[model samples]
Target chain A: MKNRNIPKKLQDNLITIGIVVVCYILVMILSATGLLSNLLQGLLVPLCAYIILAVSLNLTVGILGELSLGHAGFMCVGAFTSAFFSKCMENTITFAPVRFFLALLIGGLCAALIGFLIGMPVLRLKGDYLAIVTLAFGEIIKNIMNVLFIGRDSHGFHFSMKDSLSLGLEEGGDVIINGAQGITGTPKDSNFTIGVILIVLTLLIVLNLINSRDGRAIMSIRDNLIASESIGIHITKYKLMAFTISAALAGIAGVLYSHNLNSLMATPKNFGYNMSIMILVFVVLGGIGNIRGSVIAAVILTLLPELLRGLNDYRMLIYSIVLIVMMLYNWAPNMIALRKKAANRFGRKKEVA
Target chain B: MALLEVKNLSISFGGLRAVDDFNVSIEKGQLYGLIGPNGAGKTTVFNLLTGVYQPDEGFIHLDGEDITRLKTIEINQAGIARTFQNIRLFKELSVLDNVKVGLHNKYHYSTVEGLLRLPRYFQMEKKMDERAMELLKVFDLDGEADYLASNLPYGKQRKLEIARALATDPKLLLLDEPAAGMNPNETKELMETIRFVRDHFDMTILLIEHDMKLVAGICEELTVLNFGKILTQGKTSDVLHDPEVITAYLGE
Candidate 1:
């Protein structure tokens, strides 16, 4: 077991990387063969973004054992921040990649700042109350973004809440954000490759955290709070650590998402309670605290509707049925017993053969 | 100086004095016991000492440093570690991982070092793993190191919790009803384990137990409590034979 442990650590990381590489290659192969339709190919970046969101959300929901309904809010912060930065940099930065990297940095930092601020008061509340506070925060951020107005001029930046027109600017000044309308004319710089890279980075940060001493402290708090505290685990520090990192990763997803589109909106419908719940569903279906499960569940669920396009009216019906069945298979006692029996039978047959 | 000294410690929940004017002075390397019947506040005193609940009025000095109002984790870092009345292992984690959690603060690697998998992170982690295995070996749990802590049998789980607490390298250890559900044989073994921990670690131990037989064999000094106040404190045998202590355990 001594030497085996080293390879075991590598193996854990390899599986996530392997899944990403395999998916990327498979998509490329399909595209090369003309088997992948234009619409499906277009879905790749968004799919990767959601995979990051789901995996990061698992850090909070599954590993940290906290119910966070404001994930969409953090994503919204990142999306708007990055989009605004890209809009401002459109004429100045000739290289698209450099501009996108800057956007990502600003977006991640802004989201982490907001996460730290929000987590302070919100983390004090537990369970349902925490969930409600975060839900309310998401809605608040969305509404705030709707009315916010900012534009750049020779005199510097101006901001107001009334309307975009309120940011009276010099002629030819860039209108970075239009109230309720969100950011427009942003470059479509996000691509499948960047999305995959960000996903891998997110996996690296999260998996490494889980294998570190900090990760142990965070999980211990989840497993047994009193005992963890007794062992000198500072509950607040570790909780905020996971929460902030989770927010930062979601911010990365947001940057990827905003750059994928020519225009982005912080609409309530896009970053609201429902969006939060959807991400939570991804984490739950993936199996709480299971990173590999999160990646697989996110991919399958994200692609389910497209895969069931032939079913049309029954697409959602089939999706719901699949979800229920998957949950039962993962959790139901009789199903578990049946699975064990099948495995045993297969083992005996292999032995006899 | 005594390793742990508590004076005039008092706490009230609503109107009831859960632990009133509790006092104990435990010297370094001593094995002490606190015993009483149900609702006698044995656990409450442990809670106060560990800073789970701040005393309404009192002072607690550990190694001559004041720690009365310190937070729970701070007290732990200040050289006090405890196990729960109900075993509180990280149920889903492997046994080795459970002990490693206790070794968390002992390492100095930054979060960035951990995230980037820096050499310092691996060095410290390997050391922690080796140490965790040693602790498990002491408890005869090394064979089951990879098994989930919840999957362990009851006696083994109890032993694992103690092994985990010991991983903190505490100067003072608190065991709250360590033999609560153990049978006679298991309880006897627990007695020897406690003795081994005290002798080998050279640390002060304060435990609460219902089994007088177990306490008498190991604890050199004992205190009996009734209704949140100490009824008697003396040699283990004398405390057990006291008339007031008998009445507290039995009836009026």
Candidate 2:
């Protein structure tokens, strides 16, 4: 059984990695052959970013069995912090890629720090209360970012609550952030290759955690908190571990996203309840805890609107219809039976082949 | 010294004493039964002992160490493990993974090692898997190791819960209504399993059971409670036959 488990685990991982590599190669080929339009190529980086967000959000929502609606808040933290860092380094650093990597690290760490602080109190609450608290947190973050102002000069980076001009910077100093205006002039260093790498890295961290001992402890807590505690599992420790890691991965995705845009703002529409809900939609519309399902769902949903531009007025309606049908097909009881039968038939055919 | 000792343990909720002044002591390798009527606070006592509820007034010593104020997981780390009144197996996890969760605390690999798939991680995981399989085999559940725990039959689920608890390698095991909802034959098998666990694992066990036959067949000592207070406690036969115990059982 142990030997069988090894190969099975390896095969599952191989399949996931293989899919990612194939998609990466296909995108590269399309770009090289001039077959992929600039508009479609522009969607690639954001698609990868959304895929990472969906997968990380699934870690907390699906595997951890905790309803969190503040994933966009973590991404917002990462995006703004990393954007600010890149803005500061723009004049100093000649190499865009090096600066981008550092920004990703800083972004992920900033988000993780916030996740740890929030998870400590928020995770203690369960069910709907947890969701509400996280939602409030997301709103709070967005509001704070809206009012935030910072500037950098020879006197060093100055922070002010009033506004960007109130930071009282020296001549030739840059206004890194203006209230409601957000950080501008951020290095647009993110490319399809970088996005793909980040996506693979996100998958690696999340999938690996799902298979580890700590991961088991986390799922056990989700299954039954009392039973988990009886076995000496520290509920808070593992919860925070999953939550913080999920936040960090979302942060990495945010770094990818913000760096791709020349100007990024922490507006309500950009990083508030609607964006959070959109990410949750990706997780749920995906198969909840499934990593590969998340990637597929994110890619399909993100590309669908662009691919169906001919029906511009009805694209969202069509997408909504597809979503409903897919949910019913996946979750309806009779459909589950049919899916199982189809799977068995496919397995049998593969065996014969 | 006794392996587990409880003195003046009490807990209340909303001004009602759920478990009042409960006390017991069990030596190593002992099998003690806690039996009572409905709402008699039998499960509450198990909760207090296992740190699910902090006793308002009491001292609980395990292996001669005071563990009265420890948290649930801390108490478990101190070598105390428990099953639930309702089976609380990791329902979506595989039967093998359910047991492996119990072995989680025993693994020494760091999270970084696990994330990187280091040699130490694989080594420890392989060892834990083999041990988990062995534990399943003991419950005759080796064949169902890969099945979801929720899919198991009632009797097998019960066995798996106990198997999971044992994987914690506890010095004192607590079972809250292990025989609840079982047929007479299933109850009888549980009795044998309870005794087998005590002798085979060399651990002290305290169980709450409503099945009188099971209590009589396996338990050497018994504590009977009524309304959160101890009614009678002594050797199983003596307590089970006590006039007050009979009255309590019959509600006469």
Report the number of the highest-TM-score candidate.
Answer: 1
Worst 10-residue lDDT window, candidate 2 chain B:
B194-203
- DockQ score of each predicted structure, in the order shown: 0.58, 0.56
| DockQ, candidate no. 2 | 0.56
- State fnat for each of the candidate structures: 0.71, 0.73
TM-score of chain A of 2: 0.91
- Best candidate (score: DockQ): 1
Docking class of 1: medium
Could you give candidate 2's per-residue lDDT for residues B115-156 as a string of tens digits? 998999889999999999999988899998878888898999
Write candidate 1's Cα lDDT for A1-353 as tens digits. 12224458679788888989898889888899999988888899988888889999999988899999889999999999999888888889969999999999999999999888888887766667667878898999999988888989999999999987778888988778888888888899899989989989999999999888898899998999999999989898899999999999888899999999877888755687767776777887888898988899889877877777786577546556766887898789999999989988988898899
Residue-level lDDT for A136 in candidate 2:
91
Docking class of 2: medium
**Candidate 2: segments with Cα more than 4 A from true spot:** A1-6, A310-353
